[model samples]
Target: MTEKPAKLLPPNPTIGVFDSGFGGLTVLRDLLPLIPGARYIYLGDTARLPYGSKSRETIARYAVSSAKFLEEQGADLLCIACNTASALALEDIKQAMPIPVVGVIQPGAEAALATSEASPSTPKSVLVLATTATTQSHAYAQSLNALGLAATEKACPLLVPLVEEGWIDHHVTAEVLRIYLNEAFAEAPNAQTLLLGCTHYPLLQPLIERTLAELNHPMTIIDSAAATAADVAAYFPPNPNGAPATSRFYATDSIEKFQRLGSAFLNQPVSEVHLLDLGG
Candidate 1:
């Protein structure tokens, strides 16, 4: 008699998203509606955050540790939502995790490229607004250039702090955005694409758009957080039934603060944030 074949089980569809702090919640926010069937595990390395200041080796070590913890939690896929980590530690995290990994930088760059290419009459230049570390790394520039598009990256260090302070619509924030856009436009006058390179910058999108309009420079703005979520969603099978997504939050420090800030970024109440210790 012929033996029956062993039954094959489908892989778990849990996704792990990592960032140095609450800024990554914006990425998670966009991901929820797009891939509602998958469960999400979000980890914010708040204890050793501001990964922008750390050396690349240190960032890699921290990111790898976080990735390993998520892997232990049975994550089938990983999304590096921190621009700094995506710039410096993406490869390390990918190697350390036993799952498919996606980073924000590539998706953002691809979006800019697509936008620029779609309007051939417009200049083939992209302007990237990011944190000091990401701009210094030239990750966006390199990624765009690889696609044959010219990129100019401006480091807006103050934007992160202002956004964190919940000053998204304040006049001060608008003025700051105006100044930054003026400087960026001066550097890349013909840029037709504006890529928000830092996760936190999405909170300031309206202000950035207004500032660009005031400057008389109309350009397509690419929110990397949203683009990253869209790209990640493409990797999963569609949820035709529109199921609700379940999410768990973890932080290396200050669960209360994580919930408070994360809720703001997510535009929804963030509850039951578990504390995690990744060590010094």
Candidate 2:
């Protein structure tokens, strides 16, 4: 929906969403209801995932390759749903593709600014909790500042692994969140908006709210996945008359794991995941 183009909607358009792993499905999950008429193609670069650890150049290469793949599939628009990719290589991917490529970080910062504006804060400030690579990129800080909202980014290195392990409701996860929030709050005491900067963090949202309540720090929690979905939805309206929206799942490797874990993220069973060989 974002980065408006001269022409939009090609009559039941194809939208491609790419993530390093299952996380992007969460973005797809939100999109399904909003844009029910468009066809969705989601590709998870699972075999080469943990894009966080890669260098900027390497990450750019991988992300561009993935984006080009989706473009080849006839994608009218692309969503870089992975925060790591969004942070480090969004421009690279954008340059390589002719389609509009929306990333999670900018939409998230804009959403946080909206939240801050609606709140009673004298000046807007945001506390972002994301993976190490995302925080390290300082992407959120730069974006929020550009919008006149102060930003504080905390790297929750353990959160991704714990979420991937399906320990979302576990006490350990809650305790870890507690620590991270407390640390972030200390850095940005006036921040009234908390941005979940990573896709994996959305699944832990309920627990995060609980942790915030327990800590007595009541800040508006912003889910970037949802924000990115809304941004994409801004481009088109529902096509109820045309065929129902259908989604195709693709992965570079681990079809079984993608189906099993992806369902949790998408909130629906992922059908036969086609194995794609986008090499190293």
Give the number of the best model, judged by TM-score.
Answer: 2
How far residue 253's Cα lies from its native spot in candidate 1, in Å, is: 0.9
Candidate 1 lDDT score at position 74: 82
Give the C-alpha miss distance for residue 264 in model 2, angstroms.
0.5
Cand. 2 Cα-lDDT = 0.89
- Against the true structure, what is each candidate's TM-score? 0.95, 0.96
| Residue pairs in clash, model 2 | 1-232, 1-235
lDDT agreement with native, every candidate: 0.87, 0.89
- Displacement of the residue 99 alpha carbon in candidate 2, Å: 1.1
**What is the Cα-based TM-score of model 1?**
0.95
lDDT of 1 by residue, 65-132 (tens): 99999888988778899999999999898777767788999999888877877888888888999999
